[model samples]
Target: MALDNWFQNWHPTFFQQPLHHDPIHNSTGKRLKNPTNLLPIYFSLNLLGSEHKNLKGPSKVDAHFPTEWKSKELPFHNFKDDLPGEEYDYSLPLRLSSQPNEHYSSPHVDSSTFEKSIYTKKHHNTDETYEDHHKLKALEITGPFKTWYRWKTLDFAYPSLLERSKAIAKGDFVVENNLPLGIEVYKDRIFMSMPKWKPGVPVTLAQLPRVPKEESPPLMPYPNWDWHSEKSCDLITSVFRMKTDICGRLWVLDSGKISITTEEAKQHCPPKLLIFDLETDELLDKYIFDNSFVKEDSLYSNIIVDLRQGDCHDAYAYMADVWRFGIVVFRLADHHAWRITDHLFYPDPLAASYQLHHLKFEWMDGIFGMALSPEGDFHEDRILYFHPMSSFREFYVKTSYLRSDGDHDDGDAFKIMGESRGPQGHASSSVMNQDGILFYNLVSRDSIGCWDSRKPYKRENLGVVARSRQTLVFPNDIRLDQDKKQSMWIITNRLPYYLIEGLDISRINFRVMSAYTDEAIKGTICDPNVHNKSTYLEPPIDEDCY
Candidate 1:
């Protein structure tokens, strides 16, 4: 009955919704606890931001709340817009009351914090009237409805460097939760694109345990997630959407399934690695690799450093378990359907089927990013599985990687796509065209990009062939025999994008890049803005590096 390494070593009990509750003064006045249910992640759920997503002004702190804040009172918007019933006192504060001292906390401080200056100093523009909303104001109750009020005024709206007494003061700032999102996938792993948050802060990793899928809607009813899940890794976290296998299977790794029972790797205690069966929705197997990661600097030592979406070349599911790895094959046998870059396979599968028949590989890798081509299509490559690594800035999309290779075995992936060019904080890959053109766009972004194969692989000056977001594929993977014909899909994230057997980029569009190859896009490493010296002004749409 002793605790496993996960429980004993990590010492973290609250996983997914760590800051979902609060201790505040209730009606009785005796310090009572409450349920604000508001998250301590971002200041608001970002519903507004995503809705108002368009290229706008310079680095003006457009509602980037540094203070952890939330409200039963729908943020920014009026009260009427609050979700039905405002549900329980929606204003429950979910952030920690006090910062824990270093001694009481894990010793590791994100080393990345020190080495990489979270935000560049150039981002600080002093022209706009930036308001640090953290400060609260007294309620004046202005409207005839008597519900309207403004933030209590302070002497320093902007930094005045005033040494005199001010009127209003800084109010207690709190955080709001980013919406819980689930995606649709026909491919193995799911993807969480680069989530660039309030400038400096990137991710505050919180583990989410599996809850029933039926409960997902109720638990995470709002916010439109653009990806899908690989059923295997479902229950682990609320924020991440997993992918599935070709034949309706999910691929996930669990730490709490079966007991290690064996005493060999005592230190690596509390055995790890558990995979489930989609057919029976049960634990099919468990893998106890001796190379379990240990805890170091507050993080799991086995940290599979994400090459960061910035470094991944591209992906594809290929012959023999070999998805081209750079200039060579990364090899895959009885492999999981790979969409690694739509050009490369990292030897990881979202879920594996014990089949060794016609290779079902629709997701092909190109030179620069994920492309949906096939070196060889397996009949079983039905595409399923997904994982979103928020903090790491990499999207781990899973797909089948297991099958009966005659009598061999295979497996690896922290795992898994995308398109777009704007500082949307997005990542990209390139595809070579039928005529040798190379193009880059959102990974799996169907109809948006193409390249002239004749000139594929040109890292820079890759022509702007097209600009729509994705190539529309009727139905999802597997069922992709249907025809929607590529059309102009808009470029937006809030739209509902994934579902079980959902549409995948691999099954849809490509202009240049093909499996095992890469296409380069046109770009300038000169850092264009770095040379421009202009005064702060309204952002010009044409100049919108969106």
Candidate 2:
């Protein structure tokens, strides 16, 4: 059955509006028509009728919260309001291009001051109203554990008898110190990375194993899940982040740096980019970033693959060096790379430190998370949305300019998109769907938030998709599952507790969550039906679309 036909046949009330209104497009010019329209639904859903229990994992805490907290441990805080779930529908005008008056002029706000301002505004805005009327409610669906480490056993089994061992001696490992930060799910298996920052490596990159059946028992690295590499030095040195293209190619950015406490020089291996085939687990290509493209303080934490040309090879991959305050652009076809530096990549002084969920989290992260808009009129003309981890504002630049062989000192192409919807808090990652719905992690609120590009980027248009104290403490990464089911996946590591205090191996230390994208932002600004007209930059619709 056709996608639109399926949605209409399954849930007639899904489209609340008539189909006659002219199609509305987003700020980036992607058509946002819903099921009521003749256009294809960018994010069609399967309409899984009922919610299921959380997926199985190492500990129950991975699915639910612990019954009690230790004296030194902090408790979960509530951020939800008793506001009405349903609201009248309203619309806002689209601001496609940057305006002369739309400049980054707001002064930065520190954590304490930012908190006071947020509380004051909440009280002051009681009478204020939102122009957009669509109401949205975030419902929990299910979450998976990308990878978990337990102290009781070197080889994890359903039942165990060993006691906690701290020594790195034969088979006894300190699993808490081995953090698995990067995750990419492809096909039936999930590919993960455990950066060699502290010690022991069963396998830095391997598939997350499922609960073993009676015949099959869970293995340390899992069976036939390790990436094919002849030597330890040839494999990924340290990958804090990774990305998967539409063509089933996994891109891994090896920072080549070790934990400061473990290595005296802080350099364990040379930084490089590795590409692999997800199906065969075969290394396809590799490139050691030129010394000029990497700075002494560089920490390539995140990567964004641009496949505007319809093929992965002719495209460009943008890597954000968090500590270096710069971006490195690499052309896959030519195997050449260059650096781009700007002050915008630096941390915002006011947003450097944040008090979220009753805990203080601070970092000096520069350009970290980034996302690419759908392909523009030309093959290589998409917009690149990016931001530093220590700031609340967002920015973008044209990919055409980024891929050009220009001098690294040039900084004329970047533009400040706007500040985030609320009291400007830190975000770990951001992702945009084909329909132009941009979803991001709200670190301060322990929630997931999103904005529809059809309307102006503001607080009124932005809405929270999901929030959980135990499940979403620190969402380290988020990505669209891209499995035709319209799902978005997220992973949280309770980073503050791990970095500030210490991790509890007995309890759950990480969580992987997934939600139906359409239902996740259903009535908010991101609702495709809210605005479906094309922007000035969008190409003319084919004659048949009308």
- Which number leads on TM-score? 2
Give the alpha carbon lDDT tens digit for every residue of 1-546 in model 2. 132332222211111111221121112211122222122111110000001111111112211112222232222222233324412122332211111212213332222221111212122232332111112112222221222221121232212233224224543345565555666655444445555545544345544421111111222332232342224556566666677776778888877765532535365667889987765656888988887866665677778777644565686788887766677888999898888776567655456666655566556567766876654322224567777777676666666778888664433355554234335457778877655567787766666777765444444455666655555667777776554444566666666665556677776556545566676765444554443222112232222100
Candidate 1 global TM-score? 0.25
lDDT per residue (tens digit) for residues 449-538 in model 1: 332211111112122322222222110111010011101111123212221122233322111111111211222111111111111111
TM-score (all chains, Cα) for each model: 0.25, 0.65
Q: Model 2 — which ten-residue stretch has the worst lDDT?
A: 44-53
Show the lowest summed lDDT stretch of 10 residues, model 1: 45-54
Q: In the order shown, what is each candidate's alpha-carbon RMSD?
A: 27.5, 20.3
Error of 1 at 44 (Å): 19
Model 1, stretches more than 4 Å misplaced?
1-182, 187-241, 253-280, 283-373, 376-455, 459-546
